[model samples]
Target: MKGTVLVTGASGFVGRFLCMRLISESWNVRGTLLESESPSCLADKVEPVTVEPLGRNTPWTHALTGVDTIIHLAARVHIMDDHAADPMTEFRTVNVDGTAQLA
Candidate 1:
C-alpha cells in the first residue's frame, strides 16, 4: 500500500475531487475539514482528520503523524463581514501559517 496522504481543506471542490482521485489510485487518503458542517463530498472514501485553524502556536504534529504527503488546500481567501480589519492578516494566518504549521 502507498503511504498516507493528508489533504487539508478536503471539503472544498478541488480537494474533494483530489481525494476521490487519490482513492481511485489506491493511495491512503486522509482529509481535514475547516468547517464542521461542510459537506463530505468524499465521505467514507478517505479518513477524516481534525485540524484547527492555523494561528499562533497552532499544533499540527498530530494531524501529520503517519502521513507521508500533505496537499495543502486550506486558505482564507475572503474576509467575512465580521472578520478582522486586515485581509492580509487573515490570509497569512490561514494560508501562510497553515503551510508553516504543516512543515
Candidate 2:
C-alpha cells in the first residue's frame, strides 16, 4: 500500500478524479464529504467521512486519523455573480482561514 491519504472535497469534480487515481496507485484513500451520505461518484475503496461547513471551525480530528498525506481540494469558488455584501470574507473564511486551520 502506498499509505493512507485524506482528500478534502472528495465529492467535488477534481477530487473525485484524484481519489480514483490515488486508489489505482494502491494508496488507502479517505474522502471528506460535505453531506453525511456517501457520494455515488466516490470509488468503493475510498473511505468516506463527513466534514461539513468547511471553515476555520471545521472539526478535522476524525478525518486526519492515520492519514499520511492530505490533499486539500475544498474551497469556496465560482461566486463570480455573488450578490453578498462581503464576498471576499466568505471566500477568505473558507479558502484562507479554513485551509490554515487544516494545516
Candidate 3:
C-alpha cells in the first residue's frame, strides 16, 4: 500500500488524470513515456521514466522493479489518415508485446 505505482503512457490525457488521482491519494507514482514524447506536466509529482521502443534491447526490465501495480496506458493510437501502416502490428507491439514484457 505504500509502494510505487507504475503508470505507462503517463503523458496521455487519461493517464495524466489517473496519475493525478493517485498522487492525491498519497501513493508514489512512476510514469513512463516514449523518447520522442514530451515530458508530462505531472513530472514534478511523479517520477518520469522514458521507455525505449519495445524490443529486446529496451530497458523495460528495470522499470518494473519495486512496482506494486502497473497501469498500462501506452498503445498505438488510432488515426483517421493512417493507412500507411498495419494497425494490428502496431497495436500488438505497443499493447500486447509491451504488456507481456512488463508482466
**Candidate 2 lDDT tens digits, 1-103:** 9899999888888998999999999999999887765567676789988886778898899999899999999889997789978999999999998999899
Local error of candidate 2 at residue 101 (angstroms): 0.5
The full ranking of all candidates by TM-score, starting with the best, is 2, 1, 3
Model 3 per-residue lDDT at 62: 73
Give lDDT for model 1. 0.77
Winning candidate number (lDDT):
2
Local accuracy of candidate 1 as per-residue lDDT tens digits, 1-103 = 5889999877777888888888888889989865454545555678887777776567778778899998988777654574678777877887777677676
- Which wins on TM-score, candidate 2 or candidate 3? 2
Instruction: Say which candidate scores most in TM-score.
Output: 2
RMSD score of candidate 3 (Å): 2.3
**Candidate order by decreasing lDDT:** 2, 3, 1
Give the C-alpha miss distance for residue 69 in model 1, angstroms.
1.1
User: Which ranges of candidate 2 are over 4 A from the true structure?
Assistant: 36-38, 80-83
TM-score for candidate 1, residues paired by index: 0.83
Give the higher-lDDT candidate: 2 or 3.
2
Report, for every candidate in turn, its global Cα lDDT versus the true structure. 0.77, 0.88, 0.78
